[model samples]
Target: MTHVVGESCIGCKYTDCVAVCPVECFHEGPNFLVIDPEVCIDCGVCVAECPVEAVYDEKMLPAEQGEYVELNARLAKQWPLIVQSTEPLPEADTWAEKQDKREHLMEMS
Candidate 1:
């Protein structure tokens, strides 16, 4: 199984997880990030690195956040690979604690 980046990452776009990823599984979007299932090592390193607690093991994902598994796979195919850490969006702090932000997700980078 792979780790998935959930809705909590919709606007935060924090890349702390990316920096610690051992594989090039992360994909960058306009204001989000996704992990390519095919490339992910399921290392679990990204999970603890996420400041927003957005990363989760596929099986451990909350029922409400289950869709993120597929969302991450689909978006990973469209977005570019992000192998390093980068500054988060300016409004990251404001959006970090917000819930159900999926509608705000940008499909394009």
Candidate 2:
């Protein structure tokens, strides 16, 4: 299974996880990142790199965050691939611990 970037990443958009992904499966959007399930190696490397604990193994994803599995798959196809780590959003620190931020997600980079 692939790793899913969930709500915890919506506005925080930290790139720490991107730096550890061996398969280059991450896709960048305006304020978040998604893993291309098709390309992900399921390495679980990104999970520990994420400061916000946004990345999760598909099978272990919390029930409340299940929708992110599909969201990651769909957005990965639309957003550009992000192979290297970059600065997070300016408000990352402010949003890192915030919950229910899915409605704040932007579709474009």
TM-score of each: 0.96, 0.96
lDDT of 1 by residue, 1-109 (tens): 8899988898999999999999889999999999999999888999999999999999988999887888899999999999889999999999998988989989976
lDDT of 1 at 17: 95
Q: After best superposition, candidate 2 residue 18: deviation in angstroms? A: 0.7
- The positional error of residue 5 in candidate 2, measured at the CA in angstroms, is 0.6
- Angstrom error of the Cα, residue 95, model 1: value is 0.4
Residue-level lDDT tens digits of model 2 in 1-85? 7789988998888898999888899999999899999999988999999999999999989999898988899999999999888
Instruction: Give candidate 1's TM-score.
Output: 0.96
Please state every model's RMSD to the true fold in angstroms: 0.8, 0.8
Q: Where does the lowest 10-residue lDDT sum fall in candidate 1?
A: 100-109
> lDDT for each of the candidates?
0.92, 0.91
